[model samples]
Target: MAVTKTPIEDVAGDFHRPAEHDGVALWWLGQAGFLLRHNDLRLAVDPYLSDSLAEKYRGTPFPHRRIMAAPVAAGALTELDFVFCTHSHTDHMDPGTLPDMARASPRCRFVVPAAERMKAMERGVPPDRLILVAAGDVVVLSGNFSAAVVPAAHEERWQDGEGHDFFLGYKFRAGEKAVYHSGDCVPFDDLGDWLGVDSIDVALLPVNGRDARRKANGIPGNFHLLEAIALCRNAAIPLLLGHHFGMFDFNTIEVEAARSEIRSLGASSYAELIQPMTRYDIR
Candidate 1:
């Protein structure tokens, strides 16, 4: 089946400049993409270019349209050391962006969920550079930095028999600071036990909050705004980085309302939700 392109607005190209860093900082690169920096170490996670989903979903009414362009381009952000992919989800395992990233930053190694190793390998990501890891597996990326792979309840969370796909979330720690990217998941019965840790400084979640509710194809299966709030509040995180919000015009909740709900969650004193086109300095 021909993949539907995200609307024109969604693919508009406008690259933002990289920020100068001192300790650690995170930049939203549009959709589920991010560029994180800490001194000499740089990590790109689910880095999707602006136009990847544009032409295909242009005329589709249901799927959300892209809003602002990706914060930066693949070629623009180079010298990567680590590329973390949560799963085979297109948002994370983009075909268009991955190859260019590989070409642009040959030194970077890919850390992905162990279960999806073969799928990423099939996508020409190279067999040797792929590091397959799961929960309890700690990968010492480089100089005092490490990451722990955690299982996520993907859209197909309860699939039985032989037909199912697994999603991966990552908890990364460098010194005393840590961040958790939940990937695409819904709240589980023992969701608290999932994190295993009590707190995360910066929690990136899906304010668009998707579960198995939507029946349409190509729908963004991310966390709902409320659910994301609950996750962070329960986990007692101080900051929430909102993604999957403005990717498309129709499907996404307006940025203002999304922010309001997050702020109103009574977690604001401890938790903060930031908009796209914004950056936060992690100290």
Candidate 2:
């Protein structure tokens, strides 16, 4: 199955429209990025919308340029309630992109890992607007919205000893429904044990499995395609959306193949392969 990539301009109107669903609406911004909407509050998670990486790594080992256009321009984005970053990685928490967001949505609070405070500060995020969180922390964003920070294992344990600030996954709740975004985490055997049984309604996970080639380029990978499928099964997630693909041409999974594999395993109904710049209403 070929993926129909939606042009950024085609769906920019969707972002500006008033909240249509009383529940939650999500737009896939490509590569570990999503815009989650609940009521009047709009939250963007792990948005990498700049070509900074391409310029910085032109002569380096990981020199793949961006292959997709941004869904919405930074200056055009307004009324954003919050912006969340899982870690200090360039692709996840971009320096160029964050400043633009701050300029556009002045009131948006940036939620970042506690250890990466300096990164947020260096990116021009002011003291009053920054919210640093670690694993096990629960933050109430608005009246009907809250997030529970879950620690992530990005290749290895996300700890200071591992040279990472603090990698995290965010479990967000809106009204009665709950959604989990596994930000760049590999599936540990005990993934289900920590979160308990059938806790998630929608699960957004990465399918770019780690390999020697990606490792050689000094890039870390997330869950393998099969691992994502198994995690969805074990966690009992009713709606599974796979992301972290189709950004940089150099490092992307064969998404169509993965989608096919999921169907072959008799789990096609559970998996939702959302294209970039497309919207999905979570009812």
Candidate 3:
């Protein structure tokens, strides 16, 4: 049977609904985006809810076409408390999406890498509402919510003069439950060390493996499916939610085939290939 996707119009409504007690409700919004709800707090990470990439790269060699439509419009997410942009990439910190989102969610704050402040500002995040963070920084949102910033090695880790990372990952703690969203990362030597300390319940990782051809075309890649599973096992994270595929046709693997491979390896107990617009509640 085909899995019935929750309507795109209903995604915002679902996000605004109260979550289960002592748990986090997450909805995959295609690519590396997710809407997370805990208690009354509504948050999103790396939301790419626009076709800016497709519009920009229309006539280019790497035409950025979408395999699936955006699950929800950015303007519809009016109840958002915070949005985390892991890097300055257009897809991660969309120019078309952010402006509308900013206008919609008046009090919402955008968390961005300290190194990409200017880029984020250019992408429509107001300066006063931006919370700039570095790799070693911890942002305490409320008594029950907080985030720890960590470096992301997106192909290579780049740093500024003050050593703030250009790319980042976030370990968000909503009460006792923690979720790590590694924004466009490949495994690094100390990645396990960074994540192991957090006692993460669910890891939202990218499984769009890199290649020479894509790299030559200026498309940086992320973790392979096996590497993501290994990271979960090595870090002792109980669940791995794989993403960053099924959005772009050129950079994606066969989703069903990948799922079958995971099942064959007996890693389904801890790993899952996430589907767009589907909700997963972590208790």
Candidate 4:
């Protein structure tokens, strides 16, 4: 799917909008990134706005080519309560973008897996503002709001070791409502058990099907279309949103394919595709 760039109207304006709903307001920023706002708290996950990867690896075997322009600039962000990085992948943990965002929001805390501590530090993020989390770790943002880090099978668990926490998903809770952002993951048998199948209100997952073609090109992929539906059933997720597509010109699956697959599964009512820059009021 070709990317559709959403113009950044005004960074401050976007963040300071009047509340129209009571639950979580989520804005899809393309790729695996999202800007979530609930009351006074503001958070973002896996934002890759800069075209650094595209420029840096222009001639490399795995170049980061973007399908469209970024919706918002990193410098435009402010008053960020927290930022979450699920892993160290360039697209997810952008080196060029994170530093600028960190500098812009000096007091904002960055929540990442333990493996990203050093990387974050090297990017000049303040140690005091960095919160290293692991699987099963929970960080309470306020009295009724919290975020939980859960293990994700990206290729395999860590692929290195346990102490070095690598891939992860985040379950954001606001009172009783919960949203699970599965950062670039494939399904595992224990996923349902770990997520408490009946507790998930919204589940955001990657739908670029993993296959020999993608692997042969040296690009690791995520869950396929049909697999995504099955995963949603297994997890008992009430609402499922498809992502991890429409960002890259290469190494991505068409959005129509995902939409068609969901419809074919007769899961269209429960699962849907998220377009960039669109906000959904998850209740």
Candidate 5:
């Protein structure tokens, strides 16, 4: 029954917009967490932030200590709309951060997987605000804000009895743009078919420490190195944002290999692989 959290070192929640940046603004809060803000819509994905994460997973944590601090605190997020949790994992759906976030942004909704509803309820995310989506289920956010649930392959982990069968991936649409974020999984055969619909504008993928041989559930990773590139290539996304790296264990492939591979992809522009407390805009 252990939950995860991240430390909020810097509390000032000001984000600077680049002079040349266009359309919606993207703020990265390290690991698999990010904020995509457009007009009144604020979308947050994965929050492995606050001292709660650190305190939850001290020694022999799933991975290890993350190298960065959360860009802002859960209570500090002023304008938040919908919050999405790909699964019930601590890094993706943290116990510490969620409650504070619920308290802070009373207006934001938690769009989560069906399997994770009980966990979110345990964390105090209200019943009414919990929007559940199973694999293949779609939730439209106005004409612009929209999303579809896809299968997140945790094959090795599931086979080894480490992962739950209901873990999910998300395909989100914000106006003319489409983005995909995979919570945690090793690559699966059906990925292309799941993410093939509509021209994907951006893809936020995990290039982190997925090889969990001796760790908690042994759920490894979804897109390790080559598979991550294959996802962007198949999805036909203009930009691929590499996440879930550098936040934990400096010795893992997530910290070492992800950026180099992201830079080497065959897209018009390489995905903006970010470090902690940085923002990348989607035009």
Candidate 6:
């Protein structure tokens, strides 16, 4: 089946329109990147709308090449309100993307891990516009839009001496809907407890499972399809939007096969192997 990509030209218009459901609207921007909108607020989580990674790792074993082109450029998100960098990884924080996004959306604030403040700044996130958050902190984006910080184990959880988590995840509350974006995380024993899964309506998770070779090569891993499903079931989350594949050749799964398996599961109403640039609304 041919994949139909939503044109980059239409993205801005799509973001401004009201969602079909009474909840928030979401669009996958590839990898673990997501753009979300609710009411008047527009925000993005871990958006990697650039080719910096590919350029940096061109001849390396990982390569970091993109299988799909970026659906929208960072400079095009002129109305963006907030940008979340779950960590300092190039794909997540994106030096190339963030600087242009900052110049475009002058009022846009960046939500970064407290432990990665210096890293974020080095990647072009302005210090004044930065909203530093630790694991237990909750940031109120607006009257109805807020996010709770949670720890994420990118293979393993680590923290600095100041008790700030080096890796993090975000549980965003938009109106009455709650969406969880777990940034490059594997399933941890206390993950569900930290997420407060009962309140999460949708989970945006990575499905590129980890491996010894990748770990040894410095590429950490995240949840596989089974683990993502298990987390959703255990947490009682109704919807799961799976990502973190198809962006890199070395670290990604066979996406078409994965998508086929997800489709065959007879759970289309709940589970999805997310297509890039497509909009999903949760009610």
State each model's CA lDDT, in order. 0.66, 0.80, 0.87, 0.79, 0.66, 0.86
TM-score of each: 0.82, 0.92, 0.95, 0.91, 0.81, 0.93
Candidate 3 or 1, higher TM-score: 3
Flag regions of model 1 displaced more than 4 Å: 1-22, 56-65, 156-165, 211-213, 218-220
- Candidate 3 clashing pairs, residues 3+ apart or interchain: none
What is the alpha-carbon lDDT of model 4 when measured against the actual structure?
0.79
Q: Score candidate 2 by lDDT.
A: 0.80
| Candidate No. with top TM-score | 3
Give me the runs in candidate 5 sitting further than 4 Å from their true place: 1-22, 59-63, 155-165, 212-219, 254-268
State the lDDT of candidate 3 residue by residue for 1-283, as single tens digits. Answer: 0112343447888888776565777898888888888788888898999999999999988788998898889999999899999999998999988888889999999999999999999999999999999987888877788889999999888899999999999998887888899999998988877776758888999999998899998999999999999999988888888999988889898989999989999998788888665677776
True-vs-predicted CA distance for residue 178, candidate 5, Å: 1.1
Model 2 agreement with the true structure over 1-283: per-residue lDDT tens digits: 1112233544546776888666777788778988888888888999888888888889975686877777777656677889999988888898778888898899999999988888888876777899988877889988878998887878865677534348888999887778899888997766676566536788899887898888777888889878887788877888778888888877787877887888888887778576765667766
Residue 214 accuracy (lDDT) in model 1? 55
Write the residue-wise lDDT of candidate 6 on 124-238 in tens digits: 9999999999988989988978999999999999899898988999999977789999998999889988987347888899999999999999999999888898899889888
**Model 6 Cα shift for residue 237 (angstroms):** 0.4
For model 3 the local lDDT of residue 32 reads 87
RMSD (Cα, Å) for all candidates, in order, is 7.2, 3.5, 3.0, 3.8, 6.5, 3.3
Candidate scoring better on lDDT of 1 and 6: 6
lDDT tens readout by residue for model 4, 223-252: 876777787787777778888887776767
For model 3 the local lDDT of residue 96 reads 88
Order of candidate numbers by TM-score, starting with the best: 3, 6, 2, 4, 1, 5
